[model samples]
Target: MTESDGERRPAGELEASVLAALWSAGNPMSAAQVRAAIPQPLARTTVATLLIRLHEKGVVGRSPAARGFLYFPVADSHGLTARRMHQELDQDHDRSTVLARFVEGLGPDDEAELRRLLEGGGQ
Candidate 1:
């Protein structure tokens, strides 16, 4: 199905929506709650499946609820982003080159902040 049909969405879009919902909720939520929170018109089962996949990927955590489960994001948005950056860095063999390129791509302020962090001035 195409996006116009509302039945289909771009890859990872639903998952991102679900994660956003959970993050905004600031608490574990049932699949039904998540489905209602997200803007997408998805079935509760679909949201549950997305939560399960996120759990498998270690992106979300779940606890047994009275019915099935309540899901929550394992980390805040920034933490997840940093984890993804580490995962990307781990994929490459030439760590120094990747680090250099990443540092080179930073703006002047970001570069200075990184330098300060590296110098143990910022945490």
Candidate 2:
């Protein structure tokens, strides 16, 4: 899955995996723990890269422990999702076009759920 020289890779799935591992762990975890949690056994460098990216995104919280930085999700799954979405929208761009493309990618159940939420149907 290598790309052209120096192009950034997509980190969404990697970030999601690390966040889920942190949530399930019930405590802060190191990159090693995150790598272990990943079913396919990703490289430690990969997990570390994901952690660094997540930290840069402000979604991963860190603590300076005796060993080193321990990472944890800054928000619950839904909150993190909303935060990431809002963060993306906050970037300078055509908001309507970005949102329209996002909505267009949704499946039926997801679209319906999004509509319900947008319509103030959920808590």
Candidate 3:
């Protein structure tokens, strides 16, 4: 079904798809270029709008090009994941509880990395 047929996607899903397009390109792309790259049959205007939103969110960077602008991912997958995680953790007033829960959910390797980072070994 099409988007007009009541198929609404979550905000993050669209944002992630846009990011994936940019990431896969591995080079800066204009809004039009991005629109062409995505598999979804989205409107060119819709892709442009999403790129603008991602730019405003600081997840994408843009630079002036010939008649338009070129957009690129500001961070790779891991960096973006860390950014979102930090953003969520920062929103809670109870830092200890939030952090404790986050740590509790980490796997062994992730927990070890966290410990190393906390001890100033990892960066």
Which one is best on TM-score?
1
- lDDT (Cα) of model 3: 0.90
Over the stretch 1-123, how does candidate 3's per-residue lDDT look in tens digits?
776788777768877888999999999999888888887778888888999999998999999999678999999999998998899988999999999988899999999998999999967
Look at candidate 1 and give me any clashing residue pairs. Answer: none
TM-score of each: 0.90, 0.64, 0.83
User: Per-residue lDDT for 43-85 in model 1, tens only?
Assistant: 7778888999999999999999999999999999899999999
- Please state the error at residue 65 of candidate 3 in Å: 1.8
lDDT of 2 by residue, 1-123 (tens): 566555654567667778888899989988887889876557788888888888987888898867668999888999977886798898947999998899999999999998998899986
Stretches of candidate 3 above 4 Å error?
1-4, 121-123
lDDT for each of the candidates? Answer: 0.92, 0.83, 0.90
Worst 10 residues of 2 by lDDT: 1-10
Q: How do all the candidates rank in terms of lDDT, highest first?
A: 1, 3, 2
